[model samples]
Target: MNYIWDLIIKSERAGIAKRDISFAVAEVYSPYMELSLESLNARTAERRVELNPYYRFDHIFDGMFDINNDEDVELREQLFDILIHFLADIDLTQGLNKREFYIRFALRDLENGAYGDKVMRSIGLFGREERDMIALNLLRLYETGEAVYLLKDTMRKVFKRSTIYANCEEKDELLVYVGQEETEEARAKVGLIMDIFLPVRFHVEFYWNRHFGILGLEDTMRQDGIAMY
Candidate 1:
């Protein structure tokens, strides 16, 4: 109706009262516009039923899981409705998330109706931190396994202690100078990360360079796990 009035402005007369004309036009146009809008919405919802998965439209997921693909027609319909409606409670939005990503992955994969049981029992599979770690591992899967790069960038990220040094000694040994503050857990993780990102030729050794011995002197005495400062 407002649009009709806007169109009428372009054809308004210089000196005439045509408010009555607008009222009559609107009386005819408003119902037609309302009906057209409703029909358009209905058409859009119908499209979503074929292209998307949500609520009643979730029948798009039929024959997806093993239960839905099996010969038991009654069981398939029951389980498909039950599972989708249950997961619908977790996310009601008609948009994609991790849940949708898995669904799409299963759809595109050739292992049709294979991972249904796993998806049902996949309580610990798609946590945010877990997915983030998976993504990071994939991104760094091709990092150069060089010693200099390890000392420059990789070790800093994997180790807690900031003050550290690297040395290429004779006999194919790489000497690492580290503080006593680093924990054994951190040390082990550093070794694992280095093993993944270091060439196999170099033997890595960690020397805790904080003085901790009976002499208690810097750069001289040696203890069980501590070396010279």
Candidate 2:
């Protein structure tokens, strides 16, 4: 994750434009977005909730946490604290949306320099195969439509183990907490998803503040003698 962040920041020095950085990040992290949508569908099915309700996955688009990063409310608060450090570390103009941000950053590294090269090499992620695998799974779930109906069907089959809906308003919040806290298995599932998104969250503030040219980062970098690099 540090490697990804380093590549993003170094892209500026290597002559990678902010636009490209945004594009790359979006492309690479696209799977997380798909996961968010699929997870939302799963929750709905579990609760016997109606399809295409007012609170679609898009409604919970509260940054990557809605997908990968944060956990419950407390964890989300903690993540914001971490975000502060990242904001203080980068430079830029106006931050792009999440999708745009990832693509541009990844492309920046690919086209200009190799700031992330060693790490990717170490991980054996030479091309887009790994990226595509993640992205494709999400797409497959989305297109199959089975993922959307999975929870409901499962619940009907195993009624005792299924969760009941309390209120639609707190649906997303409830789903996250209950799924993670109700059973050890669920907790592991949540943690696994969290691990998937942790890298993105670690670098989120770096993208936002730097891409948007937040004034404080320049001052912080200068104070710490980090601006020279």
* lDDT against the true structure, each candidate: 0.39, 0.32
Candidate 1 structure quality by residue, lDDT tens digits, 1-229 = 1122222222232222233221110112233241112233342111111112222333665335443355766665456445433443343334657755654453333123232443233312233333233234323443442445544354454333433444455456555555545675556545544543456776766655453343655443544555543
Q: What digit string (tens of lDDT, one per residue) describes model 2 on residues 3-104? A: 223334455444453334321112223333321122433321111111111122344334644345545766654454344324324423246566545555
Query: What is residue 146's positional error in candidate 2, in angstroms?
Result: 7.8
- Which segments of model 2 are wrong by more than 4 Å? 1-140, 144-160, 164-166, 169-185, 190-229
As a TM-score, model 2 comes out at: 0.16
Question: What is the lDDT for 156 in model 2?
Answer: 27
TM-score of 1: 0.33
Going through the candidates in order, what is the number of backbone clashes in each?
0, 25
Maximum-TM-score candidate: 1
Candidate 1 accuracy as lDDT: 0.39
Q: Which prediction has the highest lDDT against the true structure?
A: 1
TM-scores, all models, native as reference: 0.33, 0.16
